[model samples]
Target: MKKIKITILFLALLQTFSAVAQSSKIKNLENQREQIKKEIIEINNLLSSNKKEKNLTFRDLEILAAKINIKERLIKINNDQINLLNADIKSNEIKSEELKLENENVRKDYASMIFNSYKSRLKESRIMFLLSSSTFLEAFKRSQYFSQFSDDRKKYSNKILKNLTSLDSINKILKDKIVNKEDLIKSNNAEKRDLSNERNNKNNALSSLKRKENAYKRQINQKQRQADLLDKEIDKLIKEAIRLSNENKKSSTFSLTPEAKALAESFTKNKGNLPWPVERGAIIQKFGLQPHPVVRTTKIKSNGIVIATTKDANVRSVFEGVVLSILKFKGSNLTVLIKHGNYISAYKNLSKVFVEKGDNIDALQIIGEAYTNINDNKTTLQFSIFNNTTPLDPYLWIAK
Candidate 1:
């Protein structure tokens, strides 16, 4: 019986810890859902206010598609949360039932012990028991037996009280978990409804944009050329940096400066913990091949990374490095490339520049302010990282 009570107590504590962990995960999911909702609202406002033939460029369509995708992801997360909460609630209910049964057994044992002890302690019973002894030795043995019986009774009573306290605590914890589950269910339902509305809005916006293909194609071509030119300039700078790095080698082995080496080490150490370059943003284009959202038959490839953010957000350095080049595009924006040991990080589409060629930059240092499209009020930064011209997926490096 003692072993059984101890086992029950241990299981109860474990269940309490599991509940806490689940609650934390639910809170994090809720926060992310809220952010997605805000982005959807921003997109809706942009779609409704503009009446100038809808420009309806490829970039505009891409932004709307990304918003819709985020909304869908949010809905899935909500459903998952609901399912998990329901499971937890059921588990807690089962645990509560077990606790109740254990408590009842403890109470019954305690009551039985109390009744037996009372019967043994009666005045008539005690006198009869003493007189029944045949000799002095027998009487002495009888006294010892009474003493042992009294001690056993007291111990049993104490054990029952302790079990009762534990049962009370477990019951309270289970009750709280039940309430939490109900709250989570309500929240999930609300988020699901909001996501459905956003999806509908996105469908409407996509339909309107699909009607203006000629103007959209022109815009896409111009943007593609701009992107290509930026890519070439970045490649040239990377080759130059690599050559300089090689020339400065000692004895046939390449060596980076102490500062550059330290930056590289720090950046590597924060592989999965580095923050995004933009302060407030979402990833519009992922790192690999994806079907074009608007052109169902077409596929789009992203070499580096594309982050969509609020207007005028400053692009910051991910780690300490030296500025390699600041290339001016044909339009109004500039692109800054920084070199950290053999690694390269590029920040493009900046209307204003704070860092220049040959300037030393520290981690999280501001390189430039990102440009916002006046027509759509959309701000984005094209960020990329390379290892001697070999592009790496920035998504894998940034913190989730």
Candidate 2:
């Protein structure tokens, strides 16, 4: 009986641990779902409602594509949640069965114990039991036996109550989980419907883009040329800054002062924890090379990530730094570079600038307004990070 009780306790602990683990995973997936949903809303806000599919431009197509992609991911998260709930339900059902079996065995043992105790009670009164003992030690042993029997009965009674309570709790959990699973299924179905509509919209936009394939190709080429020019200029400026900093030094990197070295070390330690350039936005384009969403055969190269935000959103510094330079050229609105020791962060496509060269800036200080294209009515900020002259992916540096 003791061994059986120990076994049941072990199983109960194991089940508790499993439930906690499963709950943690479900919570993590829920967090991811909420973040994706928020991003979809931000992207939708950036999209121009006035533009019909027939008038959709390349940037419009990209926004729609991004929204659709995120919606699919939300649906996938819902599916994962449903799968986990199903597993939980199954586990609970199995555990409930085991508890029921254990309870029955315990009740039987308890019933037998009560019946035997009743027979013994009828056979002798407590006074008669003690008087009938052959000696003092025998009488003491009999008293102990009676006390132990009573304690055992009480222990078994408590065990029965605990088992019943456990069964009730498991049943409640099962019922709640079933309801949750049903709700998730309904939610997934609704998301699927929305996803279907988004796909249709994207397809219509793609059709419009395909109709003017050659014209759009020229437009893409022109945009790429501008982007390439801006990248080259930024690279040249970074190199010049490095050369001036290392004028008398033998090393190729910046010669930092004690204070600057400490700041650099702090920045390095926060590689993945830096704030976003804009307070509210979603990344529409990532760094590096990738194929165009509409034009699969054509490749697009990006030196930095592009964040689509509301019109005239404030662009802020991700970390404390000094204003390195402000740049402007045709097709590329305005670019501001902030230097943090050997690392530099660049903010491009701004309609205004609030800081100047040699100006000391604090983390999250408003630098300028993100450029809003009047023609497309879309606002976007181009943000880049570089370790001296080498470009780093801003996505890796920014906080998720």
**Best of the candidates, lDDT:** 2
Clash pairs, candidate 2, are none
The TM-score of candidate 1 is 0.76
Name the regions of candidate 2 deviating beyond 4 angstroms.
Answer: 1-18, 51-54, 239-258, 261-274, 329-331, 387-390, 396-400
For model 2, what is the alpha-carbon lDDT of residue 216? Answer: 81
Candidates' TM-scores?
Answer: 0.76, 0.85
What is the Cα-based lDDT of residue 165 in candidate 2?
Answer: 100
For residues 1-400, could you state the per-residue lDDT of candidate 2 as single tens digits? Answer: 9999999999979978988999999998888888888888788776745354345677887787778778888999999999999999998999899999999999999999999988988998988999999999999999999899989999999999999999999999899999999998998999999999988988887886676888888888898999999999998888888878888555557878888888889999999889999988887777899887667688999988988887789999999999999999778899999999989999999999999999999999999999988877788899999988888999898875
Shift in Å, residue 69, candidate 2: 1.3
Model 2 scores worst on lDDT over the 10 consecutive residues at: 48-57
Q: Which is the leading candidate under TM-score?
A: 2
